[model samples]
Target: MNSGFHGNTFAVIIAVENYQFRIKTVDYARNDAIAFQQWLINNLKVPQENIKLWLDVDATKSALNEELQYEISNLTESDRFIFYYAGHGFYDGGYNKITTWDTHPNNIQETTVSLNRILMEPLRNSRCNQCLIFIDACASYIDEQLVSRDFIADMNTKEFSDFVRSSNYRAMFLSCSRGEKSYGSPELGHGIWTHFLIKALNGEAPEAVERERFITSTSLQNYLSKIVPDYIKSSTDIRGTQKPWAEVSSSNTFIIFEVSGASSEGSNNYIDFIFIPERLIIDFENDLIIAYLRGLENDGRHFLMYDYEGLKEIDVEAYCIRISKLKNEIRKILEEIMDFLMEYEWEEEVIFERSDDKFNISAFLYEDDKTREITVSLGLSLKISGLHPMGDTIFDSEFDVANDELKIYTDSSDYNVEEVEIQEIFSDCWDEIRRYFLLEKEIEKELLNEIDE
Candidate 1:
């Protein structure tokens, strides 16, 4: 069922910043949409031709449906589609409508695009199985004191959830809840909510890690769901009001994009790991190494480890598909490692680094119980080259860790794994090390009876 990473992802961006009718100025809504579209290009590697950007004058009711129908009609269940809207959301206490330039509150039913209709008919009926919907403008008229008394009601837009839950494999993220305002600041030059989103897309979210760096619906939701509330509470202009809502018809495990940044040595090469916690990161890297080894062994392929510089670059999506084939094995190895290291101050947090479809690795040392001399564990998550493309449809991801047979032991001194770098409390039992590096201990017992005295 895994389409892997090569699935064709299409998107439609609807940003209505100007209104020909009674809508108030929603400063920077168009800027937010434009920035989001660029993010799709830079991070997700979505083909420019696949994305449709409709802003201001063109985001009418007919245009939105026409775009969705055509795009969804072409896609399959193996592919993905996203719809993002940032502008005025007019709620008549039940029906939620995304307003266009031609939309007037008096003539809303006929003029505005019904979010429910698109999802129900064209989107649900389309060949595409998964839909990601982000609506950034909600209750704008009510929050800004612009709604007329006739439209105001004691009710809320909770019925919108019925439509949201109607579809399977769809995730919906709204800028605010039923009665809340989605804010924008002149300082940010875009909506504050959207500003944080772009930053998070670049791996700046609080949940971001050095190793596992792809942004997902869960990560984005966790980030915005927390930060937006904090910002509203902290700001003087607005407080105790706005709250972003994210709902998935099923578990939202979809990966949106990956982040790239400078390498650890301050070079332009995309870094593999950065700012990962000492214990959690080490185990992640250690397990992945084993995963790579186990996968290679299971596939009956020869394994070799070299500096990341030696690895070849290939297509990211294609590369990920290769990894997914072995991901189940990787997951098993991780579980075993967790059980094996239960005595250590272990946390399961982990991340990986890759770019252009090749992996680069890194891990740094820091003290635990900081005042004490930190125990340098048996493993080092060193940087190494990863899988290289074998052909158009296959890949080679072999790693052995040992360059030569018995070289790690006979020439153990050569490995930079001396006592200065390694610490062991009970010197005799290096059980963890033995299990990790596949070392077999051979102790010779001397016979005293054979001595001639």
Candidate 2:
């Protein structure tokens, strides 16, 4: 026979607003109840159809008593029940009682329901598999005077002991123990323990919980214990104790969710690669570049060079070993590069070429303007390209540095002007050239950093 059963879950919140209670004070309890209900519905993944909530704001003793009886009578074995009562809790010499809206300190019997009668009589005949009961109410100080003698005498009574033993699979979470008073402050709004309990359920107590881990009953109890006392001391002048209790029989654990990993940068063509210590021999068809540093021997001057055209597969192990030999100096070099890259802003532009795969880059720093311009050209090696200024005359030219020969030239005459200021004319052309190469260098640096890091 298959004995397993799954049923609907239900919650009942009674924030008593009787003729005697203050509306402002009762509002806090109602808010707490609603917040907790919503939290369970959202975070616990409990379906709306599977859960039913009953809220009674200002119910008379007769109405409250009838409602409890109806709820207990309607429960089935496949059902899970949660009952939260936030109001006045009083203990007569024989039994613990919860007050209704009409309840008064003097007229105790007509305004209260015996806690034992509420738990045992109707529930004993119902089909509920599990019941969770929360009571946030005032316990009379008068009960304490008679508790020691009366409770002992009651323990000997057959009916009281039988009821305690028979209420299995049921847990009662109380705001205060027997003979203790549960107080709520206007400043704090709700009772201290109730406040933190709601905070924990809403997933905002301390650190967020991981979605994969089950939230255990012990974790909730532990969190409440830590938060309640601290909140009380900070909010009120009275030093009172607020301890919460939980008796969990089910193995179901609570789970939470969190975000992880690095955020993505918006780039269509970017590819990210993890860094590894390898002998990187970059080949540009006609040239081969070999780079290595030995331990702390080299700092900013850590890189080695070779022509790119002469390279085959590199020995990664040998490259790492060589770099490790100069680790300290190489570390400083890398740090400087990282810092420079962090500070340097670069723009990007796409440059096209007909046949050449390699290019030359030249930078010209103007003394007059204190600004730098870069010129990039394909099939050019060891070249100096700059704007020349000579006593109110300016000329732009590209020179072959090895031969000390000017290859391309432009002067004021090219602008269809005679005796025009050379430096002023060339400065205008320098702006376009600067924009082009700055973009290219930025793209190159980005690619290089991705490779290095």
Candidate 3:
């Protein structure tokens, strides 16, 4: 038995496909809810008797009170509850409620179930150890365009940094932040967030460099926090964006499911890597990643990727870590790239050093052997090349040096970027270096903006 689950994990999943009196039906809300129910049964090993699934017409106020709420009330200190609603959510400025099949726009207060009433009050008062709620609908019926994303992870002013050891944990994994919209991926038959979420729950998410298993509140929160939004922004056409929020009361030891057992361990070892698109060649086998994809079919999410675009939503960071390899790992790789560029007769060397600021990395990246070089402070910042007694500030590149990123491994802490991101960041710096060395036409208007693209 998992630490938090001794065959006592119960879920009340509400998936509403059709609305009463023929209201606007959400695109993939029903599908998301149904799939979640199945995933709980198929992947998490939750007993069917422990789950009460209400879909479409079955998801009503009466059903919630008699069935779902009844189940919540009976939960003991050892029990865990998952309350999920994948349908339209009405946020009438202040309060948020789940829009049901019979929910009327005129009388929403009486028609729908207030989210807080169902999950918040009940779980807080109950003896249940962990109560996880997944809401994949929007709060504003007036704001229909921004409806798809409703996963709201909220913490108090200092919720994230504060963790208290508790037998009972209450958290919400919301679809989007308060104002943002959650959009669907046409390639994925279900909602975009739901697609990756199902993958996350299966322990298919990436393990931190330190730990190989993702079974804690912090690990799940960290992985999804990094991955989902990154996937969304990288999409070409999607207009709305979603950033998954979590208000977890730091129960790092709280296990969503067991990973030490043979049944789960077997599948987990094989599904370590996330699905990478065909064109993008980021080597997982050799790169600072031990978690490489064992082919999509063996990984089990192969069913979701019917079209190539489906690869866009796969949360690679959730399941893999990109640690900086043993010393000179980056230098060696850049040297190899330099050797290739030598085929064209232009020499290059990527020299890196810890800068004056402890958090910063300063480097001299040579473009033409030792003759032509640019100083790079941080990964994507270029220090102006110059001969000056007073200062080299005149010709300096003004690109902002954001955060100083390091490739740190983890047994199981929060996930971070790996070799791929670092390479690109420095590569972008190199581009700036080249532009600084080659672009003599500073006389042209808006030279900085020209070099930006």
Candidate 4:
């Protein structure tokens, strides 16, 4: 019987406003809000059954009524509950307050939610193992000429102190250091810190982390530190602070979060091939020949060459080693081909062949490998039967570089002939030819590695 229980659950609440009071001049707050939701759903691997997402432009006291409170209360029984707020925060004389859409700077009491009430009453009592709160509140001081008292206040308070002292499993990440004001820009779609947080979650910076590295909080924090600053500079006006903060429960266990199981081997192979698109055909042909030769070498096979009743010297060991090396190269190329297939969503089978002073390579693509959809082929022949020609008719004028490029020359008069038309055909086939050879080179490198090992 299967013994593993279902993985942990997470709940996220993004509350932008408190009472109906709206704070103006948020640059990318809306986009940040949406990105956070997607990060939870797609990257964080949060289960839908356990997720309760609360999003509002302005969440007033009435809006967060009994029903919303019940839902938020029920989420406490979950494994983890995360609350994220990206709006204005005010400080009354004693308590830290979050502003609603209708809040006024002069009258803080009418449109604000006490931070203590939001966390201690509903969230802390929910019975969750962990509660993480992210706040990007904008607090500023105005002179007495404009307002009776300073609206911005220090984050430290009795309620905050009590929560910190009492809740060991609770953690909080603030946008700015205490006493410093957090600023936003029209360029960044959200607060600078929040922007980086989204990127870290998306697995975009330093490339996405392997599924294995994402299990620990330390790894996740490391990833966040590396990625957030760059994203902030690029997209937002606010710069990230030197010391970002995070808190995790001492007793909490790290869990490996698996995003997906699709192998990355094929993607790497495809990238290598695309890097050197030319030489693909020559490489593939060479690899195949080498594979065949290696098999012969292993089996103690020999090819005898006779010229006009004369016998050539035979060295069996030398041939075996050479073929073995070639076979190794071929195997490497095949590995790359497999990787390329996995990275991209393409259905194609690659084939290689060589005959009578000519090397030919083809790719057959299908909806799936089982059904043939299309066939594209390129051939290199010494006889120039179907060679693409240079426009100049004088053949001896230009020196032809062997295997570097296929070339043909036709006079104005011969251009009308069907043979000249073959030049156009092969010219278009150059891209495929290059790709085949590139694949071959990668295979060769792999073989070299195997031999060394």
Candidate 5:
């Protein structure tokens, strides 16, 4: 469990599942809001008094405005603020407004709460160092009496961008892209976007590199962007319809949540060698693409290394330390992948389990009344050089370097699976495993040069 205390954090969570007017009821909005409030309390350790929750009829235009302004006024420069809404939003009379329980569709401008006034303005004017706005509304609404337009026009316009950029510590995360509906799933028992969000807050989100246990605000956005779309395509018939969006202008990346079971042994000083997309550099003059990890030691001394050999030659102890760290990282990645697969409620009985230091992913495919079962078993193989007294193995291969070497082997399963989706999942996991290794783009460039010659 996350033991971190965020007493300074404040939130206003609003969910309107059943409107007083004859508006179409939003499904599972209340559950999503409640889940989020609980997460703030349980995971972030936010005090209950700091959070104000408004459900159904309690979410009125006047109430919302008063609460928002009150919260904003109470916030200090050192504090953090979060505003969340999961309800119906509409664009009417050239204004984007989130509907209150008492909002009549015919009088949208008067009865509804303007998003600019209720959400953006206060967030901009607040002295808080970090503010997050999560709007799960904006799905197209069906009302015969009123002219309903997509909320994207107001959200994606120039004024909206300016509103986001006005403050350096403000970020807004929307559930879907323009003209796309944010969906709720019966299987997941919450809004599809919020369900994945809860999972991410619970620490199932991958792609975080800076810290193992803490999910930074930037990483949360990136994780939602990657996982939501893929899961939608695989699970729902509306494939490629919903994509998460974020307009982040925060200069500092706030640590949002401390994840459970994230820390591994020797993980504190671990250095990654992966060619992350943002940090990757191409060297045309040298005919190579370079990716490296540079970091400061415990004593504040800095070091840079392009490959394992450099570290091995400079400090054997450091090299061995990295070997242990990478080994644990590889296992952690596989465990996360297994956890992800277990979330799918497949019709065919699928067995996902880990035992004896290996992950077994078994699923059945049904085609034309014929059932075929495929199982992918994953494990690691470690080969240590005879430099240390504890291990010695005689092999045909000859070593060029006299220092110790550690070789880790993954992808032991059969790649030629019948299911294409399973194949893709395996391939993705393999790519994640490959991220902990040396420079890949340089190797690819060298191979291409050889092929060209």
Candidate 6:
């Protein structure tokens, strides 16, 4: 369900920037569409051949109909579909029409594609269970006499929900709500709403982490709700005018895109443990490491921790209490360590390698001749599960702190861990790694100078 190659997923993206009629051009419509198409192929891992893209003059009503009909005929319930439109949208003759490149201003209904007939009806009949729809339109300031109403109010109404709810998994994200224009920013090179959307889909959203950095409907909605409005309000022009809206109807959250390096197979090792507060703990007591697990059938029901050989039954309440107390003490110590670490330029967040009980993190040190970037990757191995500690032998030789309280924390999970003791342990490790990397750099420099001589 992550960013693995999903051949079954398909998309039809249309961006009508220049219309045949005398209509104002939708700014950045084409650029937005292109960005989204790239995201589908790169991030979502949808095949390039599976996507149908129509830009400017290429997006005719007939062409759109043909593509929709083709997918409707071929798609199965196992497959997923995505439809995106970025152009002029208006309401006329009791129906909302999405304007195409060949749409006529006067004869809108006959020339343009009807939103219900051409798009919604095809999706309703299509056998695909999951569908993602994104519409960015109604941005241009056109004469009301010719195009009639720009915004479609019913799109936000209950009837719109009923229409899309026919499919089990459906999410429709609109650029703006009723009476609002989907503003395009020259500064952003995209619609203001689309700007944040692309950013969020690229894994900038806060909710994206828990779901393994996958941008789901719920996550996107929450992100857009806060970010879009904040951007509008904070901007110099067009403040408090445009607000994006999303209607998601599904039993489960529908995943849209996974950020870079976010994949099911790539993150399989530390997926369960990463970001889980309980899993972050290093116990100093008897022997307990809380490991959160989720799988095919055992999803969301089991909170398990493994002992030595097999699943040893223990008091769940007492174990949780012990972990909670340890976590609180560790949290305070971590905050102090964070402050100390902030003085140095770190690469990214701390990454825990579960296979070997190794915590790997890196910091940028210096550049050699402005060509080679030097970074010291610290992999601190802790004693866990009766296994000998590996990685960085100098840590044991240089610092005795690891041999005392830190050593106990790694081996057992039943001791009363003190805050001051953990702080000293981490400080010794950090100081040792920094000194080691610096000494190595100096040695390399000396050797290079000797060779030059």
Best candidate, TM-score: 5
- All candidates: TM-score: 0.53, 0.45, 0.53, 0.46, 0.57, 0.55
Model with the higher TM-score, candidate 3 or 6:
6
By summed lDDT, which 10 consecutive residues of candidate 5 come out lowest?
Answer: 392-401
Number of backbone collisions per candidate: 4, 20, 20, 35, 0, 5
Each prediction's Cα RMSD?
21.3, 32.9, 16.8, 27.7, 17.4, 19.9
Q: Where is the poorest 10-residue window by lDDT in model 6? A: 391-400
Error of 2 at 76 (Å): 1.6
Q: What is residue 378's positional error in candidate 2, in angstroms?
A: 90
Please provide, for model 3 over 1-453, each residue's C-alpha lDDT reduced to its tens digit, 9 standing for 90 to 100: 123456478998888767785456677777788789887888777889988888888987777656666788899877778878777665543446676778775665678776556656566667776777777765422522223443222212122212222333655676764434566677787777787777677666654111354355545655665576667767635434455655554323355654433343334333323343122222445553333222332334421212222233433332222333322333443344445444555333333433221112323333422335322322221111111111111011122112222222111112223444434433433443344334433434467777886
Q: Is candidate 3 or candidate 4 better by TM-score?
A: 3
Kindly list the per-residue Cα lDDT of model 1 for residues 365-407, writing each as its tens digit. 1232224222211211222222111111111111222321211
Residue 69 displacement (Å), model 6: 2.2
Cα lDDT of candidate 2 equals 0.43
Task: Specify the poorest-scoring 10-residue window by lDDT in model 3.
Answer: 385-394
The TM-score that candidate 1 achieves is 0.53
List where candidate 1 sits over 4 angstroms from the true fold.
1-4, 92-94, 140-168, 208-211, 261-453
Instruction: List, residue by residue over 37-101, the lDDT tens digit for candidate 5.
Output: 99989977789998999999899989987877877877887788888898877666655678888
Q: Which ten residues in a row have the lowest lDDT in candidate 4?
A: 271-280
RMSD of 3: 16.8
lDDT of 2 at 56: 50
Candidate 1: lDDT of 376?
19
Candidate 1 vs candidate 2: the lDDT winner is 1
Per-residue lDDT of model 6, residues 1-453, tens digit only: 222224488888999887787866888889999999988887777899999899988898888767667766688877888888888786656566687888776776688767677777777877777788888865223443322114333233233455556665787888875445677888998888778887888787654443465666756866775577568767735533454656666334555765676554544323122111123344546333333322222222121111112322232221122433333333333344345455655432222222223221212122222334432222222232211122111121112221222221221111223445454444443454445445656887999999999
Against the true structure, candidate 4 has what lDDT?
A: 0.43
